[model samples]
Target: MTKNRWDNGITHHDGEAREFISTYFSQTGRRVLILASAGFDLRSTAVSRAIAQTGVTCRGIFIREERPNADQALRARADKNAEQLKIVVPDSKVVFIDIFDPVDQAVVGARRLTRDVLPILAEGEPPTDIVVDASALSIGISFPLVRLLDNLYGQKPGTPNVHLFVTEDPHQDDQVKPDHAERPMWVPGCDGDAGSDLKSKSIRLWIPQLVLYRTEALRRIHDFVDATETCPILPFPARDLRRGDVLLEHYRTLLIDTWEVDPRSYIFAAEREPLDLYRTLLRIDDARQKVYGQQGGSLMVLSPIGSKLLGLGALLAALDRDFPVAYLETVSYAAQLGAMKNLEPDDWPIVHLWLSGVPYA
Candidate 1:
């Protein structure tokens, strides 16, 4: 009988997981704000350590789900954990907010929490760079915060440099329910299946794991608020504050216009595997070269081998070229071709190279 090593009690980490976390910490430098829920664990501790090692200032805002004093056991555990974290990382900043209310209520509470906490932010400092760690929050709660941030502050320029990290929980894997085996199947033309043939098409959706924003961009968003009216649905008090809907509407308009005119403003990916990164770099390079034209084109390549090849190619191609030319990877030609529905045989030759795992030439 063959034995499965992992079937026992050993925890194994994948390279992609390590790479993702490393890349996240290495990428950001500004003040970091971590938003966590009651389920915070060792992963959060690891993240805090990584940030501290990077010499970046870090603050954690933990949302408590249990009532104080009523649940002594749970409260004690929570308090002990919070205390340990403080002792371990004494210099680290931490704040706790009660969120014992229901989901909708908690969401409103969080918004109000953010508003009230804004005053606690140091005065005269440029809006501290913010990073909301939504790995712990439910999608309902997490999505709202994301929408709020995106509405208030747009992405940082150059690279979407903000690091939004989500940690996958083991419990989450068990929560996925299998499809029902007894579910009825639909076939067309049969009396019972006539209308049943109208099956809903499965739509594949991709949500970005990380969202980075420029500090200035977020400040601009907050500045638009009037601070007089109470923002409804948000836990914050009603003062003469600008409506959340109005701010969000303006944000949507700006995002759409910016994306259409400047694809550089957004870096979206179905997944962030290394392969995807390589492909994205190639695509960007190709687009830049195309826009600039052959005469004045400058190639910027991110991959090490690609960069070396580009330098050599520029020299060799420079000698007998009819037009000034540079070869680089900004965008993957494969990805572009794949997006198209059909391809001519002529195009297949190039496409074949990509499909065969050959890097862009």
Candidate 2:
């Protein structure tokens, strides 16, 4: 059996990490807080250093895990890294929280910091923002933290903005050849069937941290407690418009509605499954006349065979229609002209619509 090796430095793949860091740099001058777990502490010193270099006020909350000698050594390494970070990012600050501590205590500590520590740190400074580095923690706790912050500091129409940056591990490539060259891979829709050229593939070598949010537009997120209470079916924010109706045309007229204007909006990175499915549906709707029939009537009210052919398309369209704009904002932002190809065979129809770029009803 081959022994797996673990390394403590950042690894680059697919240009994702670079893009993520660039996004933060673009948003410089905002007050930013980084909530980091042990994994992030290990993997993202470079990122932290980069943030500091931007001259933005950045703070890091490090979550420590209790362990024996070996673990202690790793913790010590992190501490050393933190110390080094202070030199590189003289303005940046750090706080350590032990995970072995009780959950209630941890929550209390986090709340006290957000409510008390952070504000004081800001010292009535103008233009403050917060970003949670939740890559290491389970979504269970991380998701709730986001909700808690929103509730504690209710978002005024245009007040001090808080940004939450939750980072996740990048997909791994286990198919390297004996020579260690990356296996040939292409994002089908992105470059089409011809396959990405060698230069594009080589430049693509950076693991991406999906920017789960666009800071300025995050109004409120449903709390974890409420989500758990409902379970299986997630509870979405209530929409003012009646079901089956299109969003008011006035919404499209807003300045933010124009392509590329707003900087402070919240954008989420949705799981590929849901986004792909939604895209497929949109494509089916777009090509309906060629594939099925006319597109005038409600796609939902079609015959059984037609509906199945459409499959999850109608359902996804309904979600986009009725749900608050935030639900699909990420899909809208990350949406490339042909980003939805290469979906699993079963998900083909839904991916087609999602890539078709049709606006939801």
Candidate 3:
């Protein structure tokens, strides 16, 4: 197997926006195009900044859920966000996607993206580099499109890379409350339904989604892995201030002092959403060889990520690298004690995937 580079770590929200464009542009020598999902929050600053700094155009596929019972204020907030993005990002067009709709329906994001979004983004630019804001999108829309676009671009001789980006501000998320009582649920999306091998000493790295509520049960991950074997490895990007984040800090303390998990486990990856973590885990020599070689080996898997892009990353790692995938789905995530719900299968609107062809290596 060839060596893969894992470029990840935390940069201050404001500082990293401009940095992402300049750095990626220089490396790839390709124009930046952000394939992002819009939300009620004004977090699109990162996307706007990248466009302003690079002067490259962007086309977006915004997934807007049709929550009929949503408060008028919520609807207004979303409207304002949509308006703000257009104003901030030059030469950008946003395609509204209602992911809950059926494939034949007019509002289905997957269909719209395939029909309207891709053609515009592809026009003029033969290889437009994609910057996906996988931080907050329904798995229904995120998965199929990512698989489609990544492969669509990957097939061409000079296939432009589909880069991943995710941003989470505990400060903003904590303003709301969620219940602490959570139940662990398993996530689907594995090839062979095999049992996890807890005896392996080889690295079984875990990419956590959000540490909002499950801070306590995280230790149980060790129960699954042998004591001699590192049960649950926690990886967090640096440049984070845990002052207000009690649960996250608590877990960090446990990882370093109580659990004796190696310092190497705490990943200093892209603060918002960087594809590096997934790429690194996918390229792991031991797991890659064992799983890819189709040897009698099982790779450990855990994902608490809230971002669908991260979820896509997890799924890709599991499917391509041959790792067994599972999730600790909370018992009830009905916006319960400020619980930051982990990503799960049911949360996503759909499970089916649509791609033009197989992904390129």
Best by TM-score: 3
Question: Which prediction has more favorable lDDT, 1 or 2?
Answer: 1
**Candidate 2, residue 289: how far the Cα is off, in Å:** 33
Q: Which digits, one per residue and each the tens of the lDDT, describe model 3 over residues 154-263?
A: 43555665665545554445443322223332333341233434325344444445455555555544444323323332234433544324444656666667767674
What Cα-based lDDT does every candidate model obtain? 0.31, 0.31, 0.46
lDDT of 2 by residue, 216-329 (tens): 221112120111111011101112222111212222232244322233321111232233334433443344334333322212111000111122222333333321111111
Stretches > 4 Å off in candidate 3: 1-32, 89-93, 101-127, 138-140, 176-210, 214-237, 240-296, 306-361
Per-candidate TM-score against the hidden true structure: 0.37, 0.37, 0.56
TM-score between model 1 and native:
0.37
Q: Which regions of candidate 2 deviate over 4 angstroms?
A: 1-29, 38-41, 57-70, 100-124, 138-141, 170-361
Separate clash counts for every candidate:
21, 24, 19
Model 2 error, position 267 (Å)? 22
